[model samples]
Target: MKFGRRQFIGTTVGAAAALSAPAVLGQARPRVVVIGGGAGGATAARYVAKDSKGAIDVTLIEPTRRYYTCFFSNLYIGGFHEMAALGHGYGKLASDYGVNVLHDYAIGVDRGAKTVALAGGGSVPYDRLILSPGIDFKEGSVPGWDLTSQNAMPHAYKGGTQAELLKAQVEAMPEGGVFCMVAPPNPYRCPPGPYERVSMVAHVLKARNPTAKILIVDPKPKFSKQALFEEGWQDHYAGMVDRIGPDFGGDVVEVRPDSMEVVIDGTVEKVDVCNVIPAMKAGHIAALAGVTDEAGWAPVVPASMQSRMDENIHVLGDAAQQGDMPKSGFAANSQAKVCAMAVRAALTGSKVFPAKFSNTCWSLIETDDGVKVGATYKPTEEKIAKVDGFISQTGEAAGLRKRTYEESIGWYAGITADMFG
Candidate 1:
């Protein structure tokens, strides 16, 4: 029946803990753990830390300290940019933004315990967890191809060393050798990525190995910016590139990495280099977290980017099954901003604002020839719905195309700065 002054303070703080953190109590700050350090995860971690201003403890978990962005990596393969340019480090995020950067892979998520198990023999607790683990290749999606065959037949889809490998293989092709690309199916990362990479490879082959041939076996009948890419191939790299759509047996394909062969609809074709971009799903860790659906993508509340399965967990970027937005770096970054704001509001009693998302995917067809597709989005009752859109016209002026290319370069620089710093 005796309530001391210390007991009164404890009860008050406990009652207000859910609403706001006590600045004078010396209690531990709220913890936010983010997995993956690319477009979405890095941006989320940076924004939450920078915006929170030390009100929350933010930790970013990534296996690589220097993240090689999947976006703009094609430019490296095309010789427009260097591999070093695509790589971004987390030093600034740690120093300037006060984010705890951990170079460790997330092996498991103990959701009930609100902790994540790392491969490096430790577990970290989190008040909020953000999963932005980009993408993972779906096994058996392309027969005869897996990570084991990556060295002989590179996918080069996730950026970094794979891109280097693919470029080297393309440059090493003997005169008039065939360079084959097995493009992935729908709902893959960067819908335009495979096509842009093909264009870059064609660009490389034209300059170094003029007589070399390029081939693309695409499961889909049409792809992102298909018309513009076709026009550029005809106008610039004419008589060099050939594509086989589903109607031409592209839908059913296999590969033999040892012999460098592609089998399309039971027709075996020998090739010099094989770049197999297989079907993709959310990175494996999302499933490990028990946040992903049967379709291999994590479903999120379109407004907040929070996991549908767990309110304390959020998913972003390529891992999220938000509607309409393409699986692209731009989309992921945009979603990250929205997610960050919602998270700050939820955890820190910050101002809550309306969520608006936008995405633009730019592709370089040839030198200074750029095409882009973009749309603005808003949250609806069911999903993130598109509001307005834009695309590069097939016959845009040369000057305009050059400007688009310049714009994409600026975007790359800007986004890297935004994410890393």
Candidate 2:
């Protein structure tokens, strides 16, 4: 409703009746410890507190006070948005929503004890736990590339400083310099993300360095919005972008950060700037909780995003494997609602609505030129099956595209408010 900004639960006769029975246990309110403060965790924390009306104790653990959203960092890279616009503080969530926002990393999750161990040497006990730890790269996914080499070849995939570093690298490149991207494999966060990053790079290069070249070495044969992105590249930044897929040995690639070289199918190319998006897995906290499977993603029940390993633990965002629903900010935010509803019902005996989820991923190709793919979903016996979907048509009008871009901007504002307030 109105793009997730609608107040989930407010004062009403039904809600008042629901709160008649307090959910407190052992002289304390029901504790909901959220191990992240991004789209999923932030929204969950806000909703659990807001809807429960102090019946639930919501504590959010996030290492950063100001979160830089990966969703719009590409626009920042393209100069369409400022870094300041991408930063969101937890003040509103703390002051307005009555959420205990802790700026700390959650190092461990003790399932048996139902406590989260913080790096600061204290443990937070929770009756219910929500884990939205986004994504972490797979070790050795990109040979010779690790945290140490991140400064040289920034992934920029996580948003924040990495994105700023990549922007600076692109801006500092010489005229006609080469920019290479080693795209991640399938099922990573944001399927269309790498292409969107390429578009952002092209947008910068087109204005600042017209002769600059952008190269993409992608492991996937086809990417999200392939034809639309390819068409936009041809029409907006022709001859400036080139994509090498697995059919062309794109999968067989390695990066030598020391030499600033990318080996594509054994052919070495010295690039002026490199962006390596490695294969991703669930965030470290999920694995620490012992909820992740061999594939490094936590499985959840379709109706509720509760972890299969522990019913008390719910996993959202990129860390969850709920099936079909792409790992995206919108998806996470949507899933958080379902999980919040379920958690409240289980704890406070509130009415539990059937889970229905939706997601829309918007990508900007150039200034005021945007495209989107979205779907409505419902839970099935096997997975979260897609009900239907829509995408930007190939021959859409420019006016429509501009409207879509504006809609996305509005969505950014609405969703952030929904999460924080």
Candidate 3:
């Protein structure tokens, strides 16, 4: 069957009959198909599968055999953490949690039929659908920046091939070579990520090439955890890192990968290594489904994370337009739990429970020291609001910094356990 936009909505009557016929009266359980088994989708699949205890069949569709979290990826480049530590397989979700993990990309959602079509040629029908496909780069947002140029100037935001590429480039740089990082504008993934990356890279460069430099080209004047990151850079690297914010005429508009140079509004600067984080939008799936708004983010009801345009589908994680919540792994994981509970309540005709969300992101400045920002939140009427949290305090004692670094590792272990193990 050709599953076009018209066909999807036109066959709902027949689809509803097929879904409600013998299956409703049979011994089988309600099925939930989740697209993208990353931070959000994997957590939702595991929770729904475990909570329902065979009363809910959870199927997760992801293109990759494994997932590498963007969190703690900077440590890999700094030579402080291994890539294996940042990687996770989906075996636990499948075997222990009883989730059906499909290693294929979701091409489209047949919302009217409550089914998800796979790029590998098949569709999985569901009683409910949860989508968290993450962000996709907006093409032509930056002149001369696209897929082909990405290979040369890696955007390590995705945390896989790009991470490896960035690490290799950093390690191969000559003594005292300049490493240029082009930070994206506001409302990008991991708001503090590019800055943290510069800190970690500076740490490595200082150890290997004492005179090496890090030049950051930012579009914004300030960033998340700006004070703490700046203090850490000064205390640790000692002027090895230099930041050029928008006020300082550092807005990048073009890139020339052929010469390993970046142009900030006509001024060209050559560098030994270049890491460009491009503008991003909701994943292609969200846009194709017509759930994303003009801002290129999926709009959903805060209480349930259900799409305002389509009740059968819910969007979460980076694809969602949840205000006051930064797009981090912790935020995605928390949102997934809320989305999971909402899906369960809707499928069983039960009342939805109140959601308490949490997010914490840690950026390692050095091997023994790290900085973090976190908050706990809840839905208030139409938006998510933070209840309480803290950012790492600057000039903290050595012992406190050490403790924070240890706490970050613990948090990572705990969240990963909750999501997959």
Candidate 4:
């Protein structure tokens, strides 16, 4: 309806203003990227995607298409369970929870720009970043222990490749061969894992080759569920499993993988099969980002799970510095939920709440018997504190151990469902 030049100019201005209104007023949903879809990252992605609905976008970056949990891998070594059972798929996170799962490793983190650099030549931008890349073996911590040497002396604690190597070694040993395992120092992932692995391997040896022996050279004076483990060893596989704690002159200072020997107190002991669980640190990505301390663990606020160095990023799982909590799969999953809630609050300007976490670790002593330790925790001002905990009592009846074994399988099913389903 413009008739003159001034009227025409006025009409054009009004139409342009109307066209730009929605673009200015309607905001886009915030994006969250999680690196390492193992225990912590998978749960965090699932929770954030489900809880946020359409208000948040979640992407999970992991190098593996499927996850092989270290939780029950000892059973696989013992032939009590198949490797298939320990492996999990991410279909639920992608289909049901609407999470974008990327099978790629994160190489770097650009905190200022909030972008995660991928190893496969791409960068993903995010409003919030959560990293749970798990533990990395500290190079040079043990002489003759490096990525190449790991192929010979496998540390099956990390699952995947190491698990396979150890399993193959166990299968190939002679009837009277000796298997040696050097347990890592304190503050490693899965405190009971190495011991459980030794127990399970001994169980296999007892059945396949009764004359075989397993020697555990532990750096610590004791380990998680030490009494229970020793009891199980004595009751089930006596003369097969021999453990040497620090008190018994059992500390490994160096490894000679080529010679199939480990040097402890300047003495070299040759073995048919060797597994060296060296000292662990945070994943390389976290260390490269400067989020980890000299101890190689990332520090975070107990209540918020927010990085002490970077507020926009949160660290969880084994990579995080969570004391008083054993680095178990259940612990990582619990930490993930807490981190999801914290991220939700940060994005929406809602109140950040205190965190409560729980951990339960189950290990198979034999084919039908299992042992477990669990705890419930609450965050204090500075750290996460354990509130209540329990371990499988010594001298427990066979029926009780059997029931615990069944219960452990059920727990595994339930946990994976809760994490990915």
Candidate 5:
């Protein structure tokens, strides 16, 4: 009845507070769903769940129960590392971090509804989504090659079973038989991967059949760590490995898996083994989400890894078109951490830190002959630009090379733990 200035203010404030109770008390837990749980997706999911301390609901969608890393898989082929060492699992992420691990493929994405359709039938809704689907091939990049023929001339780029197949094929080659590799072009998953694989193939052949030859048909005029790899090749596997560059018809090639023949500029040659790594693009799920650009890579804001096409979804690892960073497991792991921080901040009003990234890729040339290239990166307004870099020198001391190899062994252990644990 007596509503003075103070009474009027108190009555209005009470009414406003009453109206806002449900909004405050009935808020849903923020959900983050991650697809392709390899280096990027797994790391992102784990970090968001672990650091959030049950505040955020994290779900990891991966078709496979066991995840085999592409990194260091070459060592398995070369007999330096074991296949078991390359394999990882999701038990820790699920049990320790409380992550909901779904062993199902992400078939489609409804960005408008913020839900992801799974091969297992139901759709998973999320407040935010992380996609790190890695690399997929552009069909017909190599003539007469397609998914159906992959078993004949295995790419072995995806690790696990493919790596095993390539290894078995290499070991079974006849004495003095030829092994041919058709390398991928620039901006592929790993710049040094094809060359490193060549080194591994030579390692196997040199020990088993000393007269066997390994041929590399490369499109790029030069490759990652060219000087160092050349020196190592000549010193250890001399007269065993021959790399054909673009000038000598390396870039133009066709393969006949039926006959095990490689035609370089119309010069057909028979081979006992063929490893064809076709040109790569973002995985199919990224395109299904409608986040990828014309180049088939999802474009992102370097600072946050948020897709330019859809802010609610973030792209990491090989799928994102972030500049200057190679599509290595190390690079993807780094990007995942940066993305995790940004996503948590957006959801929980946490303090966001400045984005920084780094990557080091180690390639084994021979036993105890290891080389590496890496750089630190910072996000700019335009892209993620390199800050500083390092590389092993040519003719480095034997002790130093051994030490570099040891460092790689330690790194593989550390990164795996960081991803799964």
Candidate 6:
């Protein structure tokens, strides 16, 4: 479905909801500076510029020249998608929406001055700031693993090159090789992402090296769509996959990147490839802005997506600690629209409608085999609460699964277009 403004769910948080106060315009046109042009930032920039009809100035700052969608990155590892296909550019947002797209890093956020400092030694002042920067790894969350050890044991958590490196590493493993993955704890980006990656890796090994083993050492006792993934794994790659949940010392684990060893409860096992997904926090920019809480996520108002710390700034995507919403691309994109509307209302004295949000996360277990979990959310007094939800049932027909997979393909096209355009 097209995700502009939807009917806000309940009468609980009604149309009476509004921002604390509209920004006092520093310029004739209210300027909105968006940091990290992924799903959240890009969509927010586009929506604010488009909806305002040139009334608001939107500038998007993202260091990458090309952006990759982490949602479908696992398919690339499974040989179902090409790297080029996963990449997108901001040319359309610039040319079509008149957004000033800057390919520079945001080094600091001066909340007092309402300006963002760029790595290029320039700063851009904003009437309202939108931060959609994604997740960052918690330092030393995975024992003996850090960014320096990333090459030896790749954590393909972020969107781009790490996925490439991980796929390459998986392909290079010898016959009957062991591919080990240390899955992240809860509240990470994409709850099902690591499991989907595991499924994709299993898909590759099943095709190339039939005897190869796939091992997952996960800290969590159970994961998103656990029943569905387990059912799919059993149906397709029966004996090829093995997961060690928290009960089996999956929580107490360490990795020695130099030796390619995974120490599970002090039992070291040398593996051919290790995909280490460490615990994560909000993107560093959120912390720099002093918007993030002790848990390392920027909490926001459900109605406006404005930061709890600073109302002039809004947090979107994986960075925001809005309740009941998983830190996924779809969730971020959904949150951004609400934010965009609120920002516009605050800036231009436009109508602020009640906010409705929704998200659906699709995962591919095998070719033509897909499953999803999703829900619609409404703003309540305390948090963005789940209104209703649905999931793909176990033992679903082949045709349905195929249709679900195809639906994801269409969603990819629709969402990317929605974000960039």
Instruction: State each model's CA lDDT, in order.
Output: 0.88, 0.88, 0.80, 0.81, 0.88, 0.89
How far out, in Å, is residue 122 in model 2? 1.3
Query: In each prediction, how many residue pairs overlap at the backbone (N, C-alpha, C within less than 3 A)?
Result: 0, 0, 0, 0, 0, 0
lDDT of 4 by residue, 1-421 (tens): 1113333223222211111011112688788999988888888898777766646789999999889987778888888778887888999899999999999889899888889998899899999999989899988877778888878988887867678779889988998999999889988999989988988888878878889999888879889998988888888898888877777668646778888887777777778999988889888899877799989999988876788999999998899996688887878878887888888766755445557777778888886778888888888877888999888898888898888788777767666776677
TM-score of 4: 0.92
lDDT of 5 by residue, 1-421 (tens): 2223343223222211211011123577789999999999998998888777777889999999999999999999999999998999999999999999999999999999999999889999999999999999998899988888888999999979999999999999999999999999988998889989999999999899999998999999999999999999999999998889999999899999998999999999899999999999998999999999988889999999999999999999999999999999988988888888888887876667667788888999999999999888999988999999999999899998988887788778777887898
TM-score of 6: 0.94
Residue 224's lDDT within candidate 3 is 93
Best by TM-score: 2
> Candidate 2 local accuracy as lDDT?
0.88
Better of 3 and 6 by TM-score: 6
Candidate 1, lDDT over the whole model: 0.88
- The TM-score of candidate 3 is 0.92
lDDT per residue (tens digit) for residues 1-421 in model 1: 1123343223222211222233335768889999999999998999888877788899999999789998988999999998988888999999999999999999999999999999999899999999999999899999999899999998898879999998899899999999999999989999999989989999999999999999999999899999999999999999999999999999999899888889999999999999999889999999999999888999999999999999999999999999999999988888888888888878877776678888789999999998899888999978999999999998999999988888787777767777888
Lowest lDDT sum, 10 consecutive residues, model 2, at: 8-17
Write one digit per residue (lDDT tens) for candidate 3, span 1-421.
Answer: 2223333223221211111112255666888988887788888898777766566888999888888888778878888789988888999899898999999988887777777888889889998888898999988776777888888989888878789899999988998899998888878888878888998898888878888889888888789999988888888898788888887677746788889988876788888999988888988999877799998999888777888889889898999987788888878878887887778776754345567677777888877787788887888777788888888888888887777777777777766766676
Model 4 spans with C-alpha error above 4 angstroms: 1-25, 350-353
